[model samples]
Target: MTSQGLSPSDIASVVDALRELRVRSLQSRRRINNPPRLPSRKALGAVVEELAAALFPHRLGADELDDEGIDFFVGYTLDKCFRVLEQQVRRELQFSAEQAGSPVDGIDERAENIVRAFVSRLPDIRVLLDSDIVAAYEGDPAALSVDEVLVCYPGISATLYHRIAHQLHRLGAPLTARVIAEIAHSNTGIDIHPGAQIGPSFFIDHGTGVVIGETAVIGQRVRLYQAVTLGAKRFPADENGVLIKGNARHPIVEDDVVIYAGATILGRITIGAGSTIGGNVWLTRSVPANSHVSQAQTRSEIFDGGAGI
Candidate 1:
């Protein structure tokens, strides 16, 4: 106001008037007492990336990383990670407890226990990811080397994140686990929920537009090509017609199943073990083990799609 040439007294009066007006307006307030907050998800993701890189130094962009170097790096990073993650987890849990009108007395202890459980399972998770890489290498004929698969393949990277995040999810750290998994999904076109239960030797070939819904159970040695969707058809609503969450509505791909390109398998139906689902097929029913499903030809067309008829 002074810059605009208003007098000092006039400016002060204007400010007081505005303040009084705001106070009066608050008399009709609809909501109140929202606190200033920090985004826990964003913070958790940043910490997770740091921890992941430390856990897998060479694979995650450490040029000078060796076997001995990796151990030191992991140890150092875990110390820092535990501090930050534990603080954030405790804070988030306290916030949730407060919001639910519950006591936050033991949130600190619970958060520590959760972090310890998650970090302790990292070794097993890494082993599972290695198996996934081996599975991808053995399944794909075009893959030249294991290094190529590990370095360039988005699917493997995403699978690694999924494995780690899934353990956190099982430990009941949903928000932190989701942030880690979504970080992978954003980099890779594969969106697998951390809550999904995936077995060993899972391979995703040319993974793009791959969506594995929450509650989906994928069995061992399952190979899925691009644009495959193992998802639910619809959500069941509650009595008030609002959709419920945490339902087991996704498909279950059994052991040794092969779903080819552009196949969409919807609902909670099970695709039996050793079944081969052909390309560009839509399936809702359960396919028996060792069954091959392909589109039936009604007329002898030119097969202009350039696929095997």
Candidate 2:
């Protein structure tokens, strides 16, 4: 206030208006006391970084570290990361329970269990991420090496967030998992849902504007280019006009399928194995195995600034 020479009464009036809005928002949700807060995205970002470093100690971790130093750094980082993660888990559990009108009597136990299960899946997740990294390197000729792909690719970063978020989604911390996924999305422009089931050796090249929906199931060795979407064509609503949830609404991409840039495959259809979907194609039906789908060939025409075509 002093820097800008603003009056204290002006600040107080603004705060009063904000509080009125907050109260109205809480009442609209029918929230009881609004439970204090949920997990913080900033905190989860730090946790993911620590987890990434733990998984790839040499690449994501400290570069100066030797083998023994690597081990120590991983151990220390994970210990720190887990503590914060567990607290976030507790917050999410508490918030969910409150929303459901349930008591948070055993949130601590549930949070600990979720974290324990998440920890158990780390090695497997790392193995899956390695497959993705290798796939990106081998699939792209411009890629110099797997290490470069791991360090440089947006797909790698997005999938790493996916790998962690997917596990957490399965482990019952979906809100936290979704927050982590959105962090990657906001940074990389690849919006892969935490609930999506992506298989091993998935490669997304030039992965900007990609959207894989919640119920999308991608198979092994699938490759996708920028601006591809596996989305739901329609929403099924109930009698009260509320959209039904948890249905398999997105596309099921089969093994070795390649979806190119600007392709939009919608509905609960299957893209068969070894198929190649060309750029800017809008598809809604299921295709057979080894099928090739593309947009219709356009006529060559020149359009002047006027009405000429």
Candidate 3:
């Protein structure tokens, strides 16, 4: 074997195979780009970081900054972050237009509008996130301070990304929103679909293995623990035997509901307000408000010398 890697002929053969695989997978009429020109993940990550720091300037921003410096940092960071976000959103729109064989006219103006709408909603997002931070702080006894919850809690981290993603989803950048959601999921093991409508004051504790599916409607003051799955029990397919999209399959968790860890609530069931679901419960049907559902008690029998053989 030659130095540096595989021989040129072997490399050529592998490249040809990869090309064929790409063509087969994409099945698009458009020519394949070796690296598809999509939204930049790195750029989006940076934008999220900038947004986080901007939202909590004193805490997440650079250390040892005065009030004026904090203001300047927020202004500068938002300007730069929004510009990058616009570019990324433009890329998504461009890719979609090209894929649909549509005109790219007015794409720039549309991207600008979407970004502006997103920017306008920042205050509301921050408000929602503040509620989440407070919820996390109050819900966990071990949590020392609200600042600790804001800075260190995985649930709050996931909620921040989800809140950002939800705004982007509403602003017509679903692809970018999904990417941001996935970034949080990858980091925190919390899968929250951007399409899912979650209300304020939501708290997720020990947030690992939490899955909230698309179309899931979550109400305010809802608390969920680790390994909780609000997922679909079955798939409703089209006449062509293809799975139908956008069906309301996930659960609707009402306000003040507390779902414990390892609880799997499936289907389009309505979990009424103020309900408490015990750990490791596999629930399918709906439960009314103020209800507490738990697994059945285990019955044990001991056989002694006098007992039946």
Candidate 4:
């Protein structure tokens, strides 16, 4: 204790404080008994990185592999990811069943089935991500090539994570999906909910401060810039004033629409196909197809310095 420069009393005090906090947490309903464990964020993040490597074996993968060995590398990576994801999925199912106080029978079989279905869709996910890469390359004049887009664009990284997380969310493993999404959000500063439905050829340029809410539906070839938020205008409350859980709240963005930076489109309103939403626009209502929406005109007047200074 002398060598460590901490007396026994210091350790005792810290332990006592932590115990008090633990007791208080239980009283506040924030701590509960240990049952089946939940999904691990660290393991989920590793699986996501492996999936990304497998999806783009040539671009986002290891540098040591040549073209001839790419197929083998991808296969090996996919197999490894499948095994890890299956375990996590099983944990998630068991935890959920325990929370519901339901029987955990057949959870293993269900988890295996979900993982198999998710793995089978990897090729489709790759195809969708290819379209996203192409969209990013073509939409941004500064982008040099598709390879550059894949390697350098934060938007692409965020979208790839969203695609994987969205698949997990659809398969009823939402906790794991959210963990994966948060990893990408932490890395890219772009927050996309795992439940958001995004279509092919989606391009988000300079993607900092971008937020896409849960239940937001976006269509093909849609382009959005930084600070764009597709959010809920209001929450529907019940008789007791408790906010409703699951309802259509975010905006429905149609195909070929472009939302500029700093724009916020709220509620369940639709942004029609081929429409353009200007920067910093605050929109609440639905616009017709092919429309261009922007803020109202502002008039500036000259002011004399002596007026109020």
Candidate 5:
């Protein structure tokens, strides 16, 4: 206030305006009391990183540790991650219950059970991640090694977050899942919804501007390049002009399909198995299996030097 040369009355006026705005916001939006606070994004991000480290201990975790020490470190990291995640899951469930006006009795046991099931799925997630790393290394000519893909690729990072977040979304913690996915989105420009069902060995090259919608289904060994979108073509509206929810809107990309950069495949159409979509192609309809789609050929013309401008 001193630096800006604002008087006491000016400050009071601004505060009063802000208070009125806050009141208006409360009246317009849903209201709650004593709502359980979800875990911070930073904390959830740390949990994901710790889990990644535990999964690839020697590569991403403490490389200095010996065989026995590596096992111990992994165990410790897993336990710590699980404990923190359980607490967050509990808070999420409690918040949901409060929002629904449901009783929260025995929510602790339910959260613990959910977390235990989630923890048990870590090995399977690791196996899937291994396939993803291999796919990235194999698909990219510039990739030197699997370790390089795991450690350096933005696509791998986003996929890692998606895999973890997808599990959480399936287990009834979509808000937490979305937070985890957004962490990856902020770090890398890839925006993949946690509700998207993606198969193993999915690889994205130069991942900036890639968007996968919530209803998108991707099969195994699918590779996509930069600026590729699997999006909804249109939103169905009701009589009141409100957009309908839960429709199958995004594309289904089948196995072994390679979609090149700047391709937009929209709506519920299926890109059939073993198809190749060329760069900058705008596609909407479903294609047969093994189809090859590319932009229409363009003709170039040469102008004479004496041509009028």
Candidate 6:
């Protein structure tokens, strides 16, 4: 009720007027410049779907695939995938370049090269993906078959995409890598950056909320339960206290390591080979080889109150 201040109704009216002005300005700008069109995530997801069909036709598209028809099917799929993914990769690269205020030169050539290299490496990636399937089948008692794991398990699907996209990421095709990973993330709730180096025979059991940061190196035969985080403890800041990008801030899990659920091992530390990290543990320091980290054991509660409830 102060004389110097506006009433609540007046303030609300002023806010509404400003919102109307903003909407009008936005509509005018849209008419003038036409809203920028980005590629569809669903289209990118189709790329993964097609690539999966191409990679594992026998399993993913058994009814459609035959020994005699495989060559034609693969050829047709590759042709379509290359064309569609090329456009997506181009758009992603162009958008990223514009955001950075850089020129988007040689994008076509780079995308072509990326697609070619990725296709060529598909055979090898499939082998690794097979390893993952085998690992999952062997690890899980409920798994019906390798095909079941590949076709139905989100973890296996996410891992397959990660392995495929990791190659593109290493070949300096980050946009393509991002597209591939995003495809997996869309299909499955798992988010693994393609820049993370994961070795073969890796398994993600009940894989949800698993975050493996860029620059994290996971070795062969490593097993991760759900909610395991390989992240940075603290970021390294620049001169003005801004955090540096693309630094090696995540942990390294060596060969044959097992990280259980809800375990957070952070910050450039090495979990040496053949180690077993217990569930719900927080590890910030380096663990030596063949170490078994678990909670300190205590005597059973049966001794309390003469074994009564």
**If scored against the real structure, what TM-score would every candidate get?**
0.82, 0.92, 0.89, 0.90, 0.87, 0.82
Off by over 4 Å in 5: 1-24, 27-32, 297-309
Runs with alpha carbons beyond 4 Å of true place in candidate 6? 1-39, 297-309
lDDT of 2 by residue, 252-273 (tens): 9999999999998889999999
Judged by whole-model lDDT over C-alpha atoms, candidate 2 comes out at 0.91
The lDDT values for all models are: 0.81, 0.91, 0.90, 0.90, 0.89, 0.82
* 4 versus 5: better TM-score goes to: 4
How many backbone collisions does model 3 have?
A: 0
Best by TM-score: 2
Better of 1 and 5 by TM-score: 5
Candidate 2 backbone collisions, by pair: none
Q: Write model 1 residue lDDT over 249-303, tens digit each, in one string.
A: 9999999999999888888899988999888787766777898888542112214
Poorest lDDT segment (10 consecutive residues) of candidate 6: 295-304
How high is the lDDT of residue 113 in model 3? 95
lDDT tens digits by residue: candidate 5, 1-309: 448688899999999999888777656655533434775798899999999999899899975989879989999999999899988888888888877899999889988888888888999999999999999999999999999999999999999999999998888888889999999999999999999999999999989999999999999999999999999988999999999987899999999999999998889999999999989877777888899887762101112344211
Q: What digit string (tens of lDDT, one per residue) describes model 6 on residues 64-158?
A: 67789997887898789888877876776676666576987998887787778777888898899989899999988999998788878889989
| Residue 87 lDDT (model 1) | 79
Q: Which sections of candidate 3 miss by over 4 Å?
A: 1-29, 33-36, 297-309
Candidate 4, residues 16-43: lDDT per residue as tens digits? 9998887877667544566347789899
The C-alpha stretches of model 4 lying farther than 4 A from their native spots are: 1-9, 23-36, 297-309
